[model samples]
Target chain A: MKQPHIQLKLFAALTPLSPENSDRVPIEPGISIKELLDHLDIPIVKAHLIFINGVKRSLETRLNGGERVGIFPPVAGG
Target chain B: MKNTLSHRLNTLALKASLTDGTPCRTISAAEVIHLADDTGITGRMVEIAALREQILPDRYLRNMKTLSEADQIRLLESAVCIVGLGGLGGLVTETLARMGIGRFYLVDGDMFEAHNLNRQLLSSIDRIGMPKVEAAVMRVKTINPGLEVNATGAFLTSENADTLVGSCNIVVDCLDNIQSRFILEAAAKRAGIPMVSAAVAGISGHVTTIFPEDKGLENIYGPEDQLNMAKGAETRLGCLAPGVNLVASLECMEVVNLLLNPQKALRNRLLVIDLEDHTFETLQLA
Candidate 1:
């Protein structure tokens, strides 16, 4: 049987760190967003904006298998 | 009498090219000025009177089919406040002025420095020490002398936000830091106006429009803690021209939409653009 997974999208500086730079990522069930970031080697500081399945969510929000996630670094300038 | 003004406008109207070789009945900018002086009405009223008669101001003839004459007149009566006169605010002010926005409240405390020349639209070598708002007024007046401008060199803070945003149809947030963005969003909310915001760092940028009733920058930049981040990615990654102009253009487009076709404004969402990867995405926001 295949392991359950979530689609992951990383942006800007975070893009290079996506697993194999691929959008598809297999995940263990019931992982918190912060835990997932840790699993992916993203520091908590760089993960400024987090959206889970099109909704703004907190780093503490847990993700079950089969969610789509996006992470953006704080890109602030004029 | 309004009829007399209309009659005078009719006398001023002449057959002019509608920019594609099509003949159009239009009043030249010069003619509008002369008529405003002759009739003792503001140039804005003269333009409105001309538009009501289906006579195009030659300066706006090119906007014909895309925007109706009434739309042009609406543009002529609008007020916009641009909070930062750096890369994004400079382009937005210049572009909107050319588009015929009638009034402006330009606020920026900084002066042009050598570093601004790379991307700031209003900065030049000779004007290095001039206040950004002063330079902005000079450029705006030269573009459309009919415009009314209230320029301030004080920075945007809660004390000044209400004054800057009052009576304005909408606000554009070209501010560079997270702290100021929060302050601007709050002021726009209190004034019950919409704000179109954009920011750039490295080759990437983000654009979003916030309606007064909706949640603002906190969702995108995170809660109060992120504000303490001091400088953001821009400090380390730096901003370049392509990222600045592209994001600023998106903000300006949102400005136009909110003013005229407001139903189509980019509300409740964020547009992320990565020039290096050439990818653009719109994600729903709270």
Candidate 2:
């Protein structure tokens, strides 16, 4: 039997279960960000931007091991 | 009575020291009492003396007689122009006000919203709807009544930046946006004033003192391209209060040291602080 791939970890400053957070909702490997968000019940519309390893990445990008993914809402204040 | 005493002290001690060759240092109790007018600055002078003594050692205090009480008064009258009244600028204004910088040209158009309540010192429940500049002015006045604060509630565009930057001893860039920061830098350079800039993102922040002819900040942050990227990609990770306070305190120290001793200023270097990992480091850009 093959082991389950646990490659994606989501984190953010004011988000649910961020990388620096332990309550994170992890996802299996070989999944796109859109798929993972769908599986985790996270609203992509609420999270306006995404980044991997501190560089902005597209939603269609696939996850890699040990990558730090961050999600954030649009900033309205100064 | 307080103002009377302060005025009397100002007249006697300042007149004697200005006319004669007194040490021009800290005023003595006799001078304070003799100068005491009906206004009665009885408590304020004592408080100022205590603050000065605490911050300045006896050795440095012994040689102060050179400047008259009037001149000491003038030092307090110096003006500073600060941009961005946010994390760094808020605390910088507070520190300078406590130090008796009598005047400030505060420029910022943002309102005090819920998000800023965490790190910005002036953000309060009562002040949530007020403009940042207005809130900061109130806080500074509460700290020191003598400070003359003027607000420019406008974004620092190239239109009025030169006029604003030209009027102060130095410019402090605590701005978050890139284009505005670059415009402020350009204005400072064009006006030939030193700019002490600081940036805080999440648990990381950096402070750098930039002189007009120096290429220090452009080196680490890169030219306009990287700065724009950093601005655009910047997630509102939201800095904690402690992080902003630490970086703001450092910026204030840099400004004060530069004002007093220009020869030993921290020029062309970025002092980075990472509170999450407990790391304090410096990167030289020259």
Candidate 3:
């Protein structure tokens, strides 16, 4: 049996995640957003918004294997 | 210079106190002598007793006025130039305006959009489509009519950067784009004025005091190319009032503290705040 791989994409300001700054975390098959965050040690409450693939998702949303997740901090502008 | 404390106190008596009960007083040299008498520091017939020492005491005395009329005037006369007039700029402008800053040069090419109401103080349904700088002047005047505000409804670009910063003592970079930030920072450095810059990425925000002589935006944030390469949106991505105010409050604190003590100010440190976890920390940019 082959193992599934997961990719977590990080972005800030206008800068997207580069190979140097990106983190590749693998997970066992399918994991929920809450579980994925817990695995990354990220506080779910601290996240302003979360994006799984390209669409916004809530904390309870599950993540499919090889899904790219982007988590945004709160919006602190003007 | 004559002490104007007494005169200002008299004027303040007529002016209603702020919600905080602190009378907004803008003093001048001529009123210092009167202040000295009212505060029991001067006599009607006594000679001016070391006026300089009387005004600027090394230590603040309890229950006694620490600043003389002249000192008060000088402090209030300080001018701050804020560029962008967006979320961070709007908050910074409001804070400084309420702090009794004597003058401000408000610059912004953008107008109030319906989307801005989420975080911008000057944004409203009626104000939507109005220039940001114009609305800012009206709002600030309502708070402190004595404030000398110059609303320039023009975008801040590298071309006008020199002229914009030449006369202001301090420049605040509240712009979202890196190109503008770099231009404004360069202009401020050339003008020999200090700049307090703040930026936010999602819930993470950074505040730093930039002294042109020492550390600068370039060396700290890296080159323009590196900054531009990063992906961020200028439009608010669900901008919340709490988050904007949080960063604004921090920026305001640094600005006010710097105005009070320019010589001993926050320099070369990036203060980052994460409201999600209520975490506030400082990172040194060396």
Candidate 4:
């Protein structure tokens, strides 16, 4: 049996916090976006916009593995 | 805007054959300037008169087909207020001016600094201490002497936001900070105009359009206590030229789209670009 996993991508200020600096991050099945952030020690406030496989996702959305998650921070500069 | 002047300009309009063998009425930029000098009218008026007769200006020849002659006239009749004159604001003004935006209200109290040379299109070593707004206004004039612009070398504050964005067809929020952005958005809301907003941070940038009735910057940056007065991710990650210029170009496109076709405007949508991955994605903001 294969281990449950999800690809994680981080952007902006959160880029430094990405695990191994790679998108192939393992995750627990049925994990909510909020929980994934918590597991990675990424504060919820810093995750301004959360996306799952190119589509916008709510913090409460659940991931069942094999999903690509991208999180972005608030970017405001000229 | 006077009909008598327009009528006189209409008579100056002459039919010409294009390289494609299509015959159409056209007016040269020189002819428009000459008419302005002779009649003591604005070159904008003369250009408008030429467009009224379907006489396209030689200067706007490149915008043909992509923008119908009617759209060119619409652009000439439009005005936009661009707040801030740093990386994003500088390039946004440059693009819009070239696109034939007739009037502009430029606001920025900041002057060009050494760091601006990397991304600010109008910045130069010689203009290190010159106000960004002044530099932008001069550049716009050189691009199209007929364009009218009101440059304010003052930062947009609560007391002056209303006046800074007064009576414009649209507003472009190229501001650098979260607080100023919210202030500009509120002013645009009170004035009942749409605003094209964009920001940059390191290798990433995002563009969004906020109309008077939209939720505005608060949605992107979150609640007042949570993020209002805070600096954005840019301070931590830093800003660069590529993201800045790309975002400004996107904002210009939004401005033009709003002007030519309101239905196609980027209302309730956030388009994000990641330079590292070279990906552009539109996320729902509604």
lDDT of each: 0.86, 0.63, 0.63, 0.85
TM-score ranking, high to low: 4, 1, 3, 2
Q: Compared with the real two-chain complex, what DockQ does model 2 have?
A: 0.06
Q: lDDT per residue, candidate 3, B1-286, as tens digits?
A: 2345433344433232333465442323334444554666432111122222233211111212443445434545677889988788888888776655667889999998887887888788999999999988987777655457777889988788888878787888888765677788889889988888877755556677898886566544456565533324324344467766787778777776677666655586666555655646564455
TM-score, first chain, each model: 0.88, 0.66, 0.72, 0.92
lDDT for model 2, on a 0 to 1 scale? 0.63
Over A1-78, each residue of candidate 1 has an lDDT whose tens digit, in order, gives 677788887776677778873556777788898998898888888898788877778889987777888888887799
Which candidate model has the greater lDDT, 1 or 3? 1
RMSD of 3: 10.7
Q: Against the true structure, whose DockQ is highest? A: 4
Candidate order (DockQ): 4, 1, 3, 2
Q: Cα deviation of B208 in candidate 4 (Å)? A: 0.3
Give me the runs in candidate 4 sitting further than 4 Å from their true place. Answer: A1-4, A20-24, A53-56, B1-21
Candidate number with greatest lDDT: 1
lDDT of 3: 0.63
Tens digit per residue, CA lDDT, model 1, B42-152: 677788889999898888877887888888889888999999999999999999988888889999999999999999999999989999999999999888677778999
Q: Which ten residues in a row have the lowest lDDT in candidate 2 chain B?
A: B54-63
What proportion of the real contacts between chains A and B does each prediction keep?
0.70, 0.05, 0.21, 0.74
TM-score, per-candidate, Cα-based: 0.92, 0.63, 0.63, 0.92
lDDT by residue (tens digit), candidate 4, A1-78: 776888887888887888984556777788899998998899898898888876777899999988988888888888
Name model 1 segments beyond 4 Å from true.
Answer: A4-7, A61-68, B1-3, B17-23
